[model samples]
Target: MTGSVTLVEVGPRDGLQACKHPIATAARIGLIERLRKAGVKRMEVGSFVSPKHVPRMADTGEVMDAVGSRAEPGDMVLIANARGLEQVIAHGARTIAVFTAASDAFAQKNIGCTIAASLERFAPLVETARAAGVAVRGYISTITDCPYSGEVAPEAVVPVARSLMEMGCGEISLGETLGRATPCRIAAVIEAVAAHVPIEALAAHFHDTYGMGVANVWEAVRLGVRTVDAAVGGLGGCPFAPGATGNVASEDIVYLLHGQGIETGIDLDGLLDAAAYCGDTMGIAPVSRVFKARRG
Candidate 1:
């Protein structure tokens, strides 16, 4: 708990992707710059996917160009297939992330494929990324509860995480996409996945829909997860998962970790400024407790 944790800010990508109104590309760039200025070394800048499917991320190339050297070593873009990988590589992305899921139902809904099929599709992509000297990270969603399929088993996540690890992913993030899982379930899934994948190579991504985001994160940290995915202002939810809410706010995570005498290498006040900028751009108030409390 005392050691430094790496918080991968997902605000620019995951946070703004599901917005009802189109977020201007300039606003996205501003958010990313503000986050970097706040000492967020690792972040999900954007994704390389079809504009038709995810129009918000269509300007990823432009964002990358504008960010230029400001993008830190661990900054990453999500890639869904070979095409996405090619585009991100062309954009000079140093790191890329691929995603699958523990639930076949959610996979079919989100990516139009089964769990095994998705892995097969990513095989060549991962190999190609490795050869190109780009770090690869993998994500497994619906670690405990699936919107399409209810009550996923912890064991269901093991093989998916292990497969990503065996395929050369430096890190695998386990996602509680539904935001309904409590600390007990979070511990269960992490423990199960850690058995097959190295504990050091796992990250936690949680939603705050049910107000369990911070508590779930505390559980993951207790279980030895050092990397966490969060968004500024708690922006973003799973478009495919009905009723799902935004991710755990970055400000809240920094407060929790710092309060516990843990290091996150993030400045809370700077992060709040970034969050406020994000909220203003989107015309919505930040829902993070710490942000609201501090502003008051």
Candidate 2:
């Protein structure tokens, strides 16, 4: 494992998008500022998707403005086509994310396309972003298990990751989107992908649905993944996957990393404070183990 880990906070976008309550725009920006205070240099501040499809992220542009100068502007929103890319660039974004799934069933369900078609769709957007001088990150969902399709093969994920890498994506984040991945399964997926992609070129996005988020994180680290993605206070879920939970919490991941003497450059106490602020204002009990322990 590398000596340091880069934790990309996704609370402002992924964490808040599925929320039933309308998190105020100021509150959302406040989360971004607070995470910055906790030493988060990169975050997915918001998305530029259609409001009709994702009402919660309708104010992503505003959140970006509010986060102005507090942190470097990065991308986490799903860009389906050129229109989405244009909106992201118009919002002053220099980085963007395009996602594809390893499972055909989930791909079709989520984006109305087969895995091949989805990658084809992202091809133009990826080319456009690269030409426009923007950095592009690739995301692969269902790296382990898909809610719709049982056990996704590691072979199924390798080519998609390779395609993203060949398409000029600087980084590819592998998603155990349902968060049900065990250490063995997580290791298997990483092991396969690492064979095709460099360890430095890969990251992991593990969910907490089965309460195995941190364990899988540790396994990823052991397998030499230098980057991890988390949401502040564990505030995200897949709308399509019923009963699945949030992203692994930022505070919790920091606590574990600090305990293991891993350097994340994050202030754990400050991150806890931010988690508290999110929980209190959002009216949801933080799903983070460390945050709950610290609060209690």
Candidate 3:
């Protein structure tokens, strides 16, 4: 854990998407700018999906338009289909992420399609992204446990990761959507998928519902995962997955990594400021341990 790790902030998109109240577009932009100022080089600022389905993301195009020029190469918008991809491209997105799940039931519940059908859908999207010179990042949710299907076999994730990589995704983020995964389960899934896909191309996305998010991240990094997805102030949850909680906080990740002699290149103080801003704006205190411990 001594080397550098890439932390992709997801607060603006995934974090705010699950909020009960609507987050203003300006507030989202403010959060992204604060994260960038705190040295967050990679993040998911928005997504291109139907506003009716995800009203929180209705202003995705506007968010991208405001920040696209200043966004980093790794900054991206989530796209569910060809239409979403087309919209993101028009907004001048340099990178985009597509998501599916290892469990068919979870995939159907989350994206309204089967696992196979999801891949079939992403194939052309990946191809189009390649032609458009936009980098693609693929996400596989419920890698450890699925709310609809229960525990998922690690082997089930291999083909999905391979398909995403084969379809030209530069990185594959394995998501522990339920937040019930321990290091053992995390290792099992990562080991299974890493055997088929390069470990370097894998990223870890975890939730803190059962309080294992940081521990799971530790296991993933120990197993050679460099890219990690987190949200500032521990903001995020699966809308489709019942009882799930927010993502592992970016503040917690920085604290853990910096303590381990690992470099994340994020300023802890600045990150706290950003987290405070988010919590204040939303009228909720940050749930991150570091934020509570330091700011309290």
Per-residue error for 281 in candidate 1, Å, reads 2.3
CA shift of 88, model 1, Å: 0.9
Give TM-scores for every candidate, taking all chains together and pairing residue i with residue i: 0.98, 0.96, 0.98
The global Cα lDDT (0 to 1) of model 3 is 0.91
Which tens-of-lDDT digit does each residue in 71-151 have in candidate 1?
Answer: 457779999988998888888888999989999999999999999999999989999999998899999999999998899
Error of 3 at 99 (Å): 0.7
Question: Clashing residue pairs in candidate 3, if any?
Answer: none
Error of 3 at 253 (Å): 0.6
Cα error, candidate 1, residue 3 (Å): 0.8
For model 1 the local lDDT of residue 285 reads 70
For all candidates in order, the CA lDDT equals 0.91, 0.84, 0.91
Backbone clashes in model 1: 0
